[model samples]
Target chain A: MYVDMQTGTVETIMSNSDLPVVLIVEDEPDVAETYKLWLQEEYEVRMAQNGDEGLDLLDEAVDVVLLDRMMPGLSGDEVLERIRERDLGCRVAMVTAVEPDFDILEMGFDAYLSKPIRSEQLHETVDNLLDRSEYDSLLQEYYALVEKQATLEATKSSAELAESDQYDELTERVAEMRDQLSDTLGGIEDDSDFIATLRGLSEDDNN
Target chain B: MYDLTSVLEFDALSQIRPGSSILISGPAMSGKQRLAYDILADGIDGGDGAVVVTTGDGAGDVVEEFRSLVPDMNDAQLGVIDCRGDGGDQAVGNAHVHHVSSPGDLTGIGIGITKALEGLHNAGNERGRLALISLSTMLTYTDKKTVFKFCHVLSSRLDSAGYIGVFTIDSGAHDDQTLQVIKQAFDGMIDVRDAEGGGREARVLGLAGEPTDWQRI
Candidate 1:
């Protein structure tokens, strides 16, 4: 809605500096606009026509990127690789028409959305990405623990798992991680001491 | 939260709690997918997201078939793990559709389902249903042991994540061992087939307090 006709400058209607920025990197103009309309109210929404344009608009201020995988130039895959190489730290959701394959396991994106996304789907993806960005490090550890536990369970019988020392250790670590994650998630709503608490958690993770 | 009372739509299954898995086995083309889709539609109707892992049909076609039963369903309430590959890019308007390399690639399927589950969870849908359509196709591509291991991992994960799971298989295809391996992994089984008097019926097995008698469809 904040499009400057002459300069081709598109911005969210209400430019609230406090709101998180969401960049929509889609090749289809109509799709990009639809996403913009859906997200502009909650985020500082911006649109780029293709991969190159999307990269040009990328910055530290952008908290999330809804990238289309198969764009004309410098495809969304390339854009994602560049973003990771630059260590942008922004959460990238591959919003594309391509059906994901085993190649997706190697992709560096946070989330993937097939094309023709609905309004609520767009909103949910953005919100989820932002929530993840807030607790990035902690979530990684939590997920790792969960995966480890799953791996252990799948490889061992119930009697074997119950008697295994690795399972016991994993269970204890998982319990600790859950408690810490729950406490951290509770503090996310109140940003008063959020950064400080997050920093402390990250430091604890380092140790 | 992922209870079968909403998904199964049967008063008898109201006691089936969250985090339980059900196996729906029948002969080929006996409406196994239809039953699974009905379960999925029930979940969506109850405001829970639905994830469909299809080895048989394309993601779009699966969603289309689902719409035949639930006309007003939206893309926001659905996610698909499409295992069929025609070397063409397939994408639907609003649903989260992840594709695996091939039917034999259980790793690809696992990762795709995990991502879809996370997306639904992040969308604030703590309760959801995940349906793996037609284990027969999976068996065709991979060995029985591989399929069993993959199902074991997936079922265990779904159980712990508190999501209802509906898996379909062709009863006439697999041997007893194959069927038993999968049956041991699930909480219950529903065998669907032709009835004595020109109709289809489902008989629940292994679940407590349910009539062993076949119920008319």
Candidate 2:
């Protein structure tokens, strides 16, 4: 999928690359590097010390974000707010030492992982966020396919009604269009479910 | 059944009803969550089952609040699904309160709600007897479209299944457009504003087909 960073519009694109990208936005060099080391095997990892640098890396195909709550410049909350303002397509998990209070959770971090992070917690949070991102993308594709299918069904019904009206030549033309639309819609829907199931399986594997 | 008439200010909740989708809009310091707990507490005291899907708060916190509200209320009747821990099926006995890791997982939220409702129903509870308390933490991290769709699906399912769905919204955090969309989606809405003197006040906006027997807390 191709996401227009400026306009938050997502478009489907065929590309050879298949790895999901993860962006780590932590001010602490050691923490960011540790995350990179942990996640590099499964994802294309990128690191940014602050919110500004993280925003600069927004152009990359980032699927998940590991954000630190407290930073020297541009705190994690500020960075998250900016990311939302930009409508970036990445799931964020707030990694912090602060206790997971109601106020912190209410701030809208997808998942909250406290500092002194265990390898299991880090892996699970990243894996779940990626799974959700993929599922959301698949849902969008499914909705688009369903919309196309509904349009084709309507067109096909109209053509059948036209046939009853003795418009033989127009009926043939409409019938061809209907067939093409049905085939496209059916193929897209089938492919969408396949991809969605694949993503679900990958998520289960991580679990 | 307890006489709800004298227990609460009937005029305040005149717009609320059974099986209604209500948005308890308030500020962070305000008693939006407390009010939701009271509503569920009232249900449990009245022999109805309730399910709370916690997005921002922990199940223990919710249980503690309920305990404060109704100290003698049986914990068995109240189920809380905490989506704040690692994704696993951790139930607290018959209550069926499970822990979920992320708000981004709409599927998990949906599944948790389904399981909670089923548990309530299996315990001999009738339709219109279960209440859904979904704390609005997902609104901040997720996009408007995802939140809107999530609310849509949740409201639709609850309405069809005859469950009273009560959710919270932070008026200070969201824009006018998003707030308006959410208002249109719910069957009932309570605008909890700080009163001039002190405390808070709730204004009920009743949808066309909602019941007229909702009382104020």
- Binned by DockQ into CAPRI classes (incorrect, acceptable, medium, high), candidate 2 is incorrect
lDDT of 2: 0.62
lDDT (10s digit) by residue, model 2, range B37-93: 777777777777778878766777766766677777666667777777665443343
Can you give the TM-score per candidate against the true fold?
A: 0.51, 0.48
Residue B89, candidate 2: C-alpha displacement in angstroms = 11
List pairs with backbone clashes in candidate 2.
A96-A115, B13-B214
Q: Write the per-residue lDDT of candidate 2 for residues A1-207, one digit (tens) a residue.
A: 889999999875622257788888888898888888888888778789888898888754777788888888898899888876665556777888877753443355667788899877888778766655554554444333433333343455655645553345443544454344324323112211222222332233233
TM-score of 1: 0.51
Residue A87 lDDT (model 2): 57
Error of 1 at B104 (Å): 0.8
Candidate 1 regions off by >4 Å?
Answer: A1-207, B1-12
- Flag clash pairs in model 1: A116-B93, A116-B94, A117-B93
